[model samples]
Target chain A: MDDGAPAGNAGRTRPGPTTARTRARVGRLVTRAGLELAALLRATGPYATHDPTGSRAATRGLPAGSAAPPPVPQARLALVVATAGALHGAVMGSFAGPLGALYSAAKIPLLLGLAPLVCVPSFRVVHAVLGLADDEPAARRAVLCSQATLALTLLALSPLLVVAYASSSRYHVAKLVNVGVFALAALAGQLTLARHYRPLLRKDRRHRLALVVWPTLHLFVALQLAYALRPFVGNPRFPTEFLRSDWMGNVYLDLLWSLRATLG
Target chain B: MPAFLDLDRLLRGESTRPETLREGRVDLSAPRLVLATLVCGAVFGLCLGLFAATGETSDGAWQLLSSALKVPLLFLLTLLVTFPSLYVFATLAGSRLTLLPTLRLLVGAVAVNGAVLASFGPVVAFFTLFTTSYPFIVLLDVAFFVLSGAVSLGFLSRAVGVLFGDAAQGGSQGRAKLVFRTWLLIYGVVGAQMGWLLRPFVGNPAMEFVLFRHRRDSTIFEALANLLRDLGDGWR
Candidate 1:
């Protein structure tokens, strides 16, 4: 019986062809997913052609300069950027748990839906005040560029935010750090967009006004929209609610109060 | 050189030279030193536990285990309670040190305290063997703890002074001092509460040893009052 047991164990321990085949299949799937992700990031144009001339050349359907590659198509670029934004929001939301992910995922759509009604009109009014008629295309481009830059910046900073969230046991500090990271990313994105808008405003002396006005207006609208779509990152103080019952309370005030409580 | 040895030098105020402070920076960053510090803390805690269990001959081992465990737990709980506030206050005071380095400073201080406590262990053991009076033993243990804690606090203050010397010299010196004092007070209060929560560190010989005494009406303030009353009675 003992002699047969050794042989039986040897027979049972043989690696089957199915195991090798399954491993190969998994390897292929992972490679395919990675390639697709790379392609998606490339199409979004975050780290793409920083040369404005390249993008202008692409818009004119001309071959780009030797120094710069052709720009990605605007619609495809917009879609990818929006996707990145949603993904960033989702990752942030996941920090608070499952319900937070859902709340955060809804933020991108909320921003987009409100942009037409809020940001687009604000841009139009600014353009109109400056007497820059028929510059709707430029205005739209600026808006789109700003959104893309913000999304890309947030995506870039997501890893740091995730690390900070994961390492800390305290919910209050994590939430405060997350908010600080977002604010810093947003400020950086706005600066990038401001640089893009500078070329368009070269002829007008009052173009400087657009810089101040647009960002200020955008910030105001964004804050309001954020308040209305509360619980982007679920507060540990309260149970996960899809929306806060009261939108009247200011985030800054709440933050101060939380800081005080935490310190005490 | 081991970080704790360097720490001991710093605690003695014999090595305040800028280069020495910079060299001691490795203490906070080195994983080996961090591990050594924690192990030292545990060992010191064990010695304290043994001293605490001296009166309780029947359940000395159990009392020892409970007291030993509470030492590290008390340090951790106090740090958790005080760290965020310290970080915020330090930032406000314009200290250049980042969070990790600041945490290292605090941990190093605790490690220094542990070292000092371990050094005192033999003296404590001698006292334990000779003494039978409960109040006298309690007072001696408290005195040792207070001495160790003060030494640790001195180490922390000196470390902070070296790290933030420039900032302290600036206009924010008053604010920095205030922050430091406030943090010390907060640490004391939190430590007392934690000690209350992790009760019966020094077991009563009259009663059986217990890992935890069910917290009844005793707040930290009440415990302090009881200790004072015992001291008064002991004098009489």
Candidate 2:
């Protein structure tokens, strides 16, 4: 907005064009600033890596010997998930009856309490399955004992499950799912046993490959059981004897046919 | 194109469409299989006893021992059926069936099968009985076994014919001539089998056996013709 003065006179009054000497000085200052900025960036955390070198700083306030690095900000992740779940429960609750609403509400506390209990069976027993123990007899003994315990659990659980399932209006589909659940649990027991026992049995060294096969076998068996049992178990007070002959026998014949068809 | 190649191709199902069930036969070890079976059966028995204590149904511990005994018996029967015939066949072919490898192969296969059956058969049978009201699957499986038995009988017949052929052989020239004659008569019958009248008579043992028993040297050319047909399929 102002008029320009005479160039040489103004330059003399103020500063002249920068010479090579002054430019060199300015460049040095700029370089220093850049180095300082980079240092600041590293300290400010954006440029910092979360590798072994830098995580210590982030975990500084935590106490020593804490478990699993405390699930990697577990509280934050859990808080977000819980909030989402609550919102979901709200949507479900809007349509549910009083009993349904009550049941839904109880699930939150139940999950929180039960999640820790899961670590007990998993860590205490199953983790042993993958460990490097050469004691076959001991491993076998442990597996048998665990299986016995699990079998007992099933025995105890089945009656209660059957009773609850019987009480449900969805009894037909319920029994089928129960069959699948039973088969899966049995297969899981096999997997657990196989993991530990495989190293001992030379043939079972193939059990690592058996891992892929065994699950597939059980699932097929389950589906066949489901298809066969679907008609009978769904009906209460139905004659069990007649249904058994058709469904159970037919299923075996089909399996035998498949065996003959595939292997024989 | 080679006879050996044809044999290999037969085993691999290239020569036969929906290859003959005979293709599946392979050698197994006997003693190890038997041991495996016995151990498995006992383990299964004890486990069954233990589980019976916990499960809804109780199969007495006797189930296991009976199962163990039954499996080996089946093994014994299969050996009785297959081994004698196989030995006879090999003997007729001028091969020694009592040789160490042959004995090992035959015995091992039976034993291995017996062991596998001991482990798996009971479990399957129990569940089939448990789930399906009828023994429908068992019957179908039994039918397959029946078919296997017929095929075994055919092998036995071949074995018997070989024994006679051995008895008939006095010299390599005579034996070679006899083989050619026998094969020619067989093809003549097979060629006649293309007609309706011979169709019913084709598998008639009396007629076919006569062709084999009274065969002459002229049959070699027909066998060559068969080789041509076989190779043509492969090339196509």
Candidate 3:
């Protein structure tokens, strides 16, 4: 411990040519990944200027298809939802144990994916009824993109959950922490959605009505699903089951009970 | 399917455009609008009935059937009760819309209302599946009805404005617009009472499932106030 060489100098001396090459390769891979992630982050943000038709390619004197990235496919966005959702789910259930973690990892993606799918039919109807049927595809992409943003934001905030769990053993505090994380993530997703909807809104004022309808439907469904798939932060008083036995119970009723308990 | 397309066209404001209204008719098929309304009302009713169905009451199935049947009746009967007065006032105010065209326009508005309500069906059913609180569901349903009613009335109001205000060229048309506006209030009052008269839409968990509750002494407004107070009291 006492014989400390300079960190950078020591590493330089230890590596042979192959090791150095390997390290360089790894470094390049990491840099590439970092750039890709940064691009994704920028795309989701409101401030980023996106030209989906590859006009930037011509402007830069490159062939149109060569420089412009294709619009993110639904399959890839779904994959992002799955991967990022699983990561956040892992953190949420880390306080419980391995089995709980696995269960949560499986459920979070479903929560993200299914909630919107259930509401899409009605959303489509609303759009068609409002004479915005032609804009439905773009609107759907906006919804999916926002969901992906939500998942990524939740993943980014998972570290805070880890830290809170590390610092506190209180189960209720753990619940509050998770709730706080989710609320922040939801706000981020909503902002991204609104940003995505801005062009559509500019095209027609009725998109504003759709903007109101989507969240009302999504949140109402999501809340119940979240309640049903409970025990995310397992209580020490109970065994760590994937779902509580009374999983069919209502969130509104539980909330009332909690309020009464607190008041009494 | 064709009827649904017709309903869709009506929803797009195509049927109620200023030019279309100026032609002296709402461009909609009466049978199609009625059919769409029935399907949509039944869909919303099925969602409303989920509370009782999930409550483990012995008469849950019966409640479901009754609710499904009553919802269509609710709108149609409300229209029937309110239409005569609206017609009298509209004629008195010198609207050119004949009996059939006027009825068709009202039916189209109801179809819009039903469609909006049915769109909200999934939300209600989701809550009903999990929620044990009767007062909360009652309040939620009321809120949704208010929202859907507002939307439908907005559609009707716009059509009336086009028919009587923008299209027609006289001061008498302004009077026609006022008559329709006055009728909206009467429609709301009658609709609320009709809903009250057809009680047990969302069956109370504590009570046995009945087709209808005994006529309560209080008005719908008083009952709603009580529910609000009870809900605020933390009935748990």
Give Cα-based local distance difference scores for all models. Answer: 0.60, 0.34, 0.76
Clashing pairs in 3: none
Give lDDT tens digits, candidate 2, residues B1-236: 12223223322424222222132222322333345544543443333223222233333233334433433444444344333223322322233222333334344333333333334444544554453221233332333333433342333233323423444455532343343334333323322222111111112211211211212222323533654565466557
Q: Tens-digit lDDT track for model 3 on A79-119?
A: 98899999899989878888778889988998999999989
Across B70-164, the per-residue lDDT of candidate 3 in tens digits comes to 88888887887677546544643545565556777888888999999999999999998777899999999999988998999999898888887
Which 10 successive residues of model 3 chain B have the least lDDT summed? B85-94
Ordered list by lDDT, greatest first: 3, 1, 2
Instruction: Report the number of the highest-TM-score candidate.
Output: 1
Winner by DockQ between candidate 3 and candidate 1: 1
Candidate 2: interface RMSD in Å?
44.1
Kindly report the docking quality category of candidate 3: incorrect
Model 1 lDDT per residue over B65-111, tens place: 77777776766666765665465444345343444455666776766
TM-score of each: 0.47, 0.21, 0.46
Largest DockQ belongs to which candidate? 1
Measured by TM-score, how close is model 2 to the native structure?
0.21
TM-score of 1: 0.47
